[model samples]
Target chain A: MSNYSKVSEFKDGVKKGIPIGVGYLAVSFTFGIWAVEGGIPLPLVVFISLSNLTSAGQFAGTGLMLGLASYFEIGLSVFVINIRYMLMSLSLSQKLDRSTKVGQKLLFGYGITDEVFAIASTREREVTAHYMYGLILTPVIGWTLGTFMGAAVGIILPERLQVAMGIGLYAMFIAIIVPPAKHSLAILCTILISVGIMCLIKYVPFIKIGEGFALIIATVAASAVMAALAPIKDREGDAHE
Target chain B: MNKEMYYFVAAVVMALVSYIPRALPITLFTKQIRSRFIRSFLYYVPYAVLGGLTFPGIFYCTDSFWTALVGTLVALIVAFFEKSLVIVAAAAVLSVFLSGLFL
Candidate 1:
C-alpha cells in the first residue's frame, strides 16, 4: 500500500476503465446502429447514449420510438431492466469512501455500470471520488463517441459488417460472467437457473411475458435462491480473474 | 421531427427512474447496517443478475444460432483462462464472423 499514491491509484482506475470502455464502445455501437436502423434519428440515438450510459436500459427504452410500445411500456421496461443497478449501487455504496461528499457521491452514482461496479467493489481499499471519476471518464467518452460514430456510419456500413458487430454485445456479456462462473459452482448454477427460467418463459406458450418483466423475474428469483443456498462468507475474499 | 416530444420526455423520465435506485444506496451504505444476513445477500446479486443477462440472450443475438454458439464457445474458452475482457469479446465476435462464412 505504500507505493499507492493518489495519482497512481487514479491512473490505475483509468487503466481499468479502458477495457470496460472499449467493450462498451462496441456494445453501444451496436445499439446506435440498431436504433438508427429501427428508424430513430441520429441525434436522438446520441442523446440516449449520452444520457442513459447503460446498455440494456437504453435498448429497452427505444421501444417508444418504434410504435411497437407505448411510452408507459417503455418507462416500465427501462425500470425493470435497470433495477439491477440499484443492487449494484447498494453493494457499491458499502464500498465508497466514508468521507465522500453527498454531491460527489451523487455524481459518482450515475457511472456504476456492471463493469465499473465489478472492478470497484472487488478492490480491498475503499474507492475514492478521484478514483471513481478517473474510472468513469473514459467510458463516458467511449459510450457517447461510439454512439456518434455508429449513428453517423450505421447507414453506410456494409451488411456483413453490421451483422458481425451484433455479436460484440453478447461477446461482452460472455466476457463478464464466464470467468467467475468458471471458478464457482454457485455462479454456474445462477447462470443455469436464470437462463433456464428465461428459456421456459421464452419458449413456453403459457408462461410468456414481456422482455423487461422476464428479466426482472429471472434476476430476482435466481439471486434470491442462490443467496439463500450458497452464501459466500464475507471474509472468504473477493475473486478476480 | 417536430412532434417527438414524447420520446424526449420518455428519455428524461427513464433517466430519473434509473438514477434513484443507483443513488439511494449511498445513504444506506454509509450507515452501519444492523443485519449481517442481508449484507451478504447483496454481495451475490451482481453475479446472479449478470448470469441472468448473459445466456440464452447471447446465443440468440445473432441471425444464425450456429454462429452464436461457436462464438459463445470461443468466448468461454478464452474467458476460462481469465483473458482480458477485450480479448474475450473480440474472440467471440471473430469466431462468429468466421463461422458465418461456413454456417
Candidate 2:
C-alpha cells in the first residue's frame, strides 16, 4: 500500500477506535476502583490494566487474587473468561487482508479485544495491519489512563457513588449483547440458555460450582445447544452480518 | 513466596493466559473454519458469554436490590434503542445513583 493510503487507513482506524476508547474509559475506571477496593495496590492495578487490557478477565483474576485463591484458580478463571477471544481471533483472521504479514498478525492479534473485533470484522474492506494498530493504540491508552485515574482518586469519591459505578461494566455488557440479541432469534435463544444455565448453577444447592467454572459451563452448554438446534448454513455471508 | 511476589506472579499468569488465546488464533490460523458446528458455536459464544456474565451479577452490583433493578431496566431500555456503550452504561450508573437517594 502507498504511504498516503496507509496513513489514511491508520487515521480512519483511530477515528473508529475513539468511541471504543471513550467507552473503555468508563468501564476500566470502574474496574480500577473495584480492584483497588479489593485491596490491590494502585500501581499493580494500573499494571494489570496495561497488560491484560480486558475488563472481565482482569476483574475475575484480580478478584481471585484478592481472595488469596490459588494461582491455578486465578489462571483458570482468567483463561476461561477470556477464551471467547480465541473465537473472535479466528473469525477476524479470515477478514484480514491477504498481504498482512505473519509478524503483523502476531502483533495485531494482541490487540483484538471484543470491541476491536466487532468494528474490524464489520468493515466493508479487508482489515490491514496499520489500521489495526491505530485502532488498538487509542483503547490501550484510554484503558490504562482510566485505570490510573480511578485507582488514584477513587478513594475520594462518595461511598454511594462508588457503589453505583459498579454497574457500569455490566451495563456495557448488556449494551453489547442486547443489540445483537434483538436482531436474531438464534442469538436470543443462545443468550437465554446461557442465563438459564447460570441461574441453575447459582441457585441449585446440589450443584456447587465456582464462578469461573460456572461461566465456562454456561457458555459451552448454551453455544453447543444453539449451534446444534439452529446451525447457520451460510458461514461466510451470514456469520459476519 | 511473599505477598507482593505472589501478586506479581499472578498478574503475569493472568496476562499470559489472556494473551495466548488472542494471539494464538489469528497468528496460527489463516484458513477458514470448515466445521459448521464449530462456526455456529463460535458465532454464539459472544452472546452466551456476555449474557452469562451480565445477569445475576448485575443485580448485586449496587447497594440495594431496588437500585440495581432500576439501573438494569434503564440499561435494557437504552440499549434496546441501540444506543452506544457509553450512553447505556452511563444511564445505568446515573439511574442507580439517583435511585440510591430515594431508596
Candidate 3:
C-alpha cells in the first residue's frame, strides 16, 4: 500500500476504535481506584491499566494479589483468562494484508481485544499497519488515562459506589456477548459451558481450588470440551468482502 | 512485604507483558483469515466467554444455592425479555438482595 493509504488506514482505525476507547477508559477508571482501595500502589495501578487493558483478568489478578497468592498462581490465572484473545487474534489473522511484513504483524498483534477485534474484523480489505496502529493508540490512551484518574481519585469515592462500578465491567461484557448470542448457538453453548464450569469450580466439593487456578482450569476445560463436541461450521457468507 | 508496593510493581510488569501479546498480532497479520478451525473458534467463543462470565456474576453471591438459584433465575428471566443492561443487572442484584433479606 502507498504511504498515504497507510496513514489514512491508521487514521480510520483510530476513529473506529474511539468509542471502544472511551468505553474502556471509563470502566478502567473504576479498576484504577479499586486497585488502590484494595491496597495496590497508584503507579502500579496505572501501569496495569496501561499495559494489561483487560477488565476481567485484571479484576481477577487484583483479587488474587489481595489474597497473597504466589507468582506461579498469578501467572497461571492470567494465562487462562487471556488465552481466548489469542484465539480471537489468530482468527483475525486472515483479514490482514497478505504482503504485510511478518515483523510488523508480530508487533501489532498485541492490540487485539474484544473491541479492537470487533472493529477491525469488519474491515473489507487486508488490514494495514496504520489501521492496527490507529486502533491500539486510542484505546491504550483511554485505558491509561482512566487508570490514572481512578488512582488519583481513589480515596474520595464512596465504597458502595466503587463496588457498584464493578458492574460496569460486567456490563461491558454483556454488551460484547449478548448481541451476538441472539444469533448463534455455538456462542450460546460456549457461554453456557463457561458459566457452568465456573459455578462448578465455585461450589463443587473437591474443586474448591483458588480463584486463579479455578479460572485457568475452567476456561481450558470448557473451551476444550466445547471445541471437541460442538465445533463451529461456517454457515453464512463472509460479512465483509 | 510492603504489600501495596509489591502489587504496584506486579501490576506494571503484568500490564507490559499483557499488552505485548495483545498488540503484536494485529500489527503483524494482514490477510484474509483462512483457517477454518480458528474461524469456527472465533465465531462461537464469544458466547462461551459471556456465559462463563455472566453465570458466575449472578450466582457467586448469597449463602446457599437456593438464594443464588432464585436470584439468577429472576435475573435471566429479566435479561431475556429486557434489552437494557442496567435492568438485567438490577434484576439479578435486587433478587439476590431481597432473597438475602427475607430468608
Candidate 4:
C-alpha cells in the first residue's frame, strides 16, 4: 500500500473497528467503577485501565490491589496474566512488512490486545501504520473515557452491581470464543486444556502458583503445545486478500 | 482535581507505552510475505490466542468452583450455537446468579 492509500485505508479501518471500541467502553466503564469501589484512587484506576488496556490483566491486578498486595505481587501478577501478548506480538511480527521500522513495530506492538489483534490480523492486505493508529484511536478514547467516567460516577454504584459488571468482559470473551469452538476440534481442545490447567492450578494445593504467574505459564504453554501439535496449512495469498 | 490529574497523567504515559506496540507494526509493515512457514504461523496465532484467552476467562471469576463451572458450561453451550455476546453474557451471569442461590 502506498502512503496515500495507507492514509485512506486507515480511515476505512477505523470505521470497521468502531463497534469494538464501543464494546470496550461499556466494559471499561464498569471496571472504573469497580476500581473506585475497591478504594482505588480515581487516578490510579485511570492509570490501571489506560496502561494495561486489558480486561483480564487489569481485573487480576485490581483484585490484588484490593487485597493490599505488594508491588512485586502486582507486577508479577500482571506479567503472568499478560505474557500471552508477547506471543501475540511475536506471531504478528511476521505479518509486518520487512521494511517496517523497528520503532514503528515496537510502538504498535504495545497495544496488541486480544480484540485489537483479532481485528487487525483478519484484514487480507498488509496492515499499515495509519490503519493501526486509526484502529487504536477509538478504542483508546473509549477506554480512557469509560474509566474516567466510571471513576467520577463511582459513588452511586453498589458492590453487587460492580460484581455484575464483570459479566461484560465475560460476555465479550464468550462472543469471541464460541464460533471457533463450534467449528474446530483443535480450538475446543485448546479451551479444555486451558480451563483444565487453570482449574488444577487454582484448586490443587501442591501446585499453588499465584494466579498471574500461573496465567502466564498456562497460556503460553497451552498455546505452544497446540501450535506444535496441529500445524496449520497455509493458503495462498490469504493474509493479503 | 489533584487525584484526577495524577491519573490522567498516568493514563497518558501508559497509553503512550501501550500504543507503541499496537501501532508500530501497522505503520511500518506493508510488505508481502513470501515464506510458507511465516504465513501458516500468522494464520494460527489468532486461533491459539483466542483459545488461550477464552478458556481462562470462563473459569477465573472466583473460587466458587462449582458455580463457576456450571455457569461456564451453560455459557459455553449457549455460546456454541452462535449466540450473541449479550445472550452469552446473560446465560453466564444468570447461570452464576442462580447457581449462587442453590450452592
Fnat per candidate? 0.60, 0.76, 0.37, 0.33
lDDT of 1: 0.73
Candidate 4 Cα RMSD (Å): 5.4
lDDT of 4 by residue, A14-59 (tens): 8756756766775677788888887778778877776778776678
Q: Candidate 2, TM-score vs. the true structure?
A: 0.79
TM-score of 4: 0.68
lDDT of 2 by residue, A1-241 (tens): 4233788889989987886787677557777888888888888889899999888788888989999999999998899878778767876776677677888888878778877876676566778899999999889998998898889997334778777777876887887878888888898999999999999999999998877678778988998999899998864644533
Give each model's whole-structure lDDT: 0.73, 0.83, 0.62, 0.63
Model 3 lDDT tens row, A87-151: 55655665566566767766667667666765565455556777888888878888888888888
- Highest DockQ scorer: 2
Best model number under lDDT: 2
Off by over 4 Å in 3: A1-19, A34-44, A56-81, A95-108, A113-131, A155-163, A209-241, B1-12, B23-38, B58-103
Chain A TM-score by candidate, in order:
0.76, 0.71, 0.68, 0.72
For model 1, residues A91-184, the per-residue Cα lDDT tens digits are: 7776666677888888978888767877786566777877888898788888988888888886334555556666665666677777778778
Question: Model 3 misses residue B35 by how many Å?
Answer: 6.1
TM-score of chain B of 2: 0.80
Higher-scoring candidate on DockQ, 1 or 3: 1
Top of the candidates by TM-score: 1
Worst 10 residues of 2 chain B by lDDT: B40-49
* Model 1 segments more than 4 A misplaced: A1-5, A30-42, A66-74, A121-126, A153-158, A234-241, B1-6, B32-34
Residue pairs in clash, model 1: none
